[model samples]
Target: MTKPENTGYDYDVVISGASLAGSAAATLLARRGVRVALLERHSAPETYKVLCTHSLQACAYPVLDELGLVADIEKSGAVHNQARWYTRWGWIEPRAAPTGPALPFGYNIRRSTLDPLIRSRAAETPGVDLLLGHQVTGLIEEGGRAVGVTASTPRGERRIRARLVVGADGKDSAVAKFAKVPVRESENTRFAYLAHFRNLPLPGGMSHTWFLEPDMAYAFVNDDGVTVVAVLPDKRRLPAFREDLEGSFLEFVRALPEAPPIDSAERTTKIIGTVNYPLLSREPTAPGVALIGDAALTGDPLWGVGCGWALETAKWLAEAVAPAAAGRGDLDRALELYARRHRRRLRGHQLLAADFAKARPFNPMEQLVFAAAARDAAMARHMYRFASRLIGPRRFLNPAALARAAAVNIRYHRIASRTARRPHKVA
Candidate 1:
């Protein structure tokens, strides 16, 4: 396509896919005085993604707080939860210790409430116009750069022109497809399933997980007296679950030590699940276009990193491009800045998550850290930091840190052996 002489744009930016990432980006960009057109294929305002467990990671709390949505989210009855992992050794639950601070907590509200709340906020923002039932069809290229999008709407089709086009869509992003973004794919060796239940209370309102090596189970607490029981077992066990999903899920959860009251709790939702989900990562930026959230990276769902990354990435994208979007600076430079930030922040975490998503036993390094964590509070905090994405993977994998964990684990085991050999006093 030949270069078209400069034409007027309806908005500064056109964002396709108005889910968490799309809507959040629209709000942030608009708040910075950049006009935005947010598009969503779903017409109903209340529609939410059912396939998700919808747990936000602690790393994202600051973003919510920054957006001034924390109070309203709490008012919506979202539960605050910290994670505890149950290994064969014991629960690697972190507490306040001399070596570090306490683990931060995150929110667990269903998507039904979260999606609409964020979308509504974007719609109400001064410079954002939320367009519903508008699915992206293609991009308008000028001088070999995307300058706008053509979307299929209820009436027919509309060409929305803008200086920049941002794709906040999902893993199967049409925006990315039209833009010809390069993709890096990884395989998922395990499948995931989840169901909601009532009358399922947890201690301290915290979430719990059992890491049974190749397979895993969880009882994640959510809002409105709901608990989301989920499992990510190896593909080898898929047949048993497929035969009887309810029975298999219940039996798996009940078999864990100190399990929730699944027998007494009433199942509220159907067995929502996904199999054959490949881990996906994409080049986040191109000429005149950018991608955020799942459109850029889709890690394994078991870790629940999607929601947190969505809000945080949107924050970064908006900050980097606000001046450009408002016509104050060069937009090309802004896209490059956002791309660098995205790769620097999330690339390592995404790779590590993909590696572990494969069905396999815990390697020696994993066992060493987990064993030490269960026996030592400081190690537990370190592991939690890594798992929470508060610290980078290198911090957890350094030779010095691994050696320290080994020392801690050996000391605890030696002391336990000595105590076991000692005769108990007669009572």
Candidate 2:
């Protein structure tokens, strides 16, 4: 382990990252009167990576509401609505499915805007100390347990000792690295390129996703008249993309027939790309530390599950670990329960996402269901429920739905075969 330059230890809970998961955890823990220190590598509170599409699905809204952020987010002009998915077959429309009274749909907010808002709120909460410009360089170990973090800042090296150390540092978490936790890689097929565009005419009040067989694209209307556009392609094509990110990204989105017409729109930011970052997780908890957000697990962005998962994990860990942190019970046992609950709640979603990311052209079953929805409003509603995460994969893939999907696939294939045998029609 690399030693930090300066070291003076203090604090009850030290968090190594100050992004979504770290900030959320700090807010909740501080509100409960637990002394918290949030450390971030960046000096500017406004500094945030502009990588995500920034769409928060409905599954995450409840967690946000519980954090007292829903109203603030809405006031910040976040878009709230179900996104419309356009496949080769047809459009999957939105439907209203109630999870609870206080929650109102999903939201789309720029991470650049949202990150600072969250961090500011966390700083204001009592019992929390926000330390910017501090980079965590090593973990402080006491008797083989992670008791704190050693970080370097402008003032030099300092050690923040705590009963618990939380690693919310994201996918490439240094905490995860230092702990020597094992990560199991999945078979990842898709690579993504994302950018923001201005003067793009998006479907009013709803986001859009176009599934073009092996390729997928999406656009969301976020705050500041900006639309977040992303293209997800097979991993083999990533090399060409890396060479000329902007050109390749535009071409990919333009090729999707269902994507918004953006030929005239101007790219407001440089295109960003991520390739082969497959969703994986080790044990999220060990000894005196716990991992949340992308540190715990990273799923396919195709579903826009990252932010929601981050918030959810923060809430779960906050509730699970608070009592133990307060000395009411064994902290180790609390972390074990947190790990079990986190896995149990998210295992189904992670498994499905991993399988889907293989990027095989949609199988017959998928075609059937999508085709059925094109022809039937009721089927579309069912599909919407699944897409919005109101229903699990098992319920969505029940016998009746599967049978209909299979029948549709067989019929579509026969038609395609006949069409291939015929002369090409003039446009």
Q: Encode model 1's per-residue lDDT on 106-211: one tens digit a residue.
A: 7999999899998998888888888999999999999999989999999999998999999998999988999999889999999999999998887777889888
- Summarize candidate 2's per-residue lDDT along 212-288 as a digit string, tens digits: 76777888888877888888988888889888887888788877765567789888887876786687867899889
In TM-score terms, candidate 2 sits at 0.87
Candidate 1 lDDT at 261 equals 83
Q: Candidate 2: which pairs clash?
A: 6-157
lDDT values for all models: 0.88, 0.81
Task: Name the top TM-score candidate.
Answer: 1
Show the colliding residue pairs in model 1.
Answer: none
Q: In candidate 1, residue 235 scores what lDDT?
A: 92
Task: Give each model a TM-score.
Answer: 0.95, 0.87
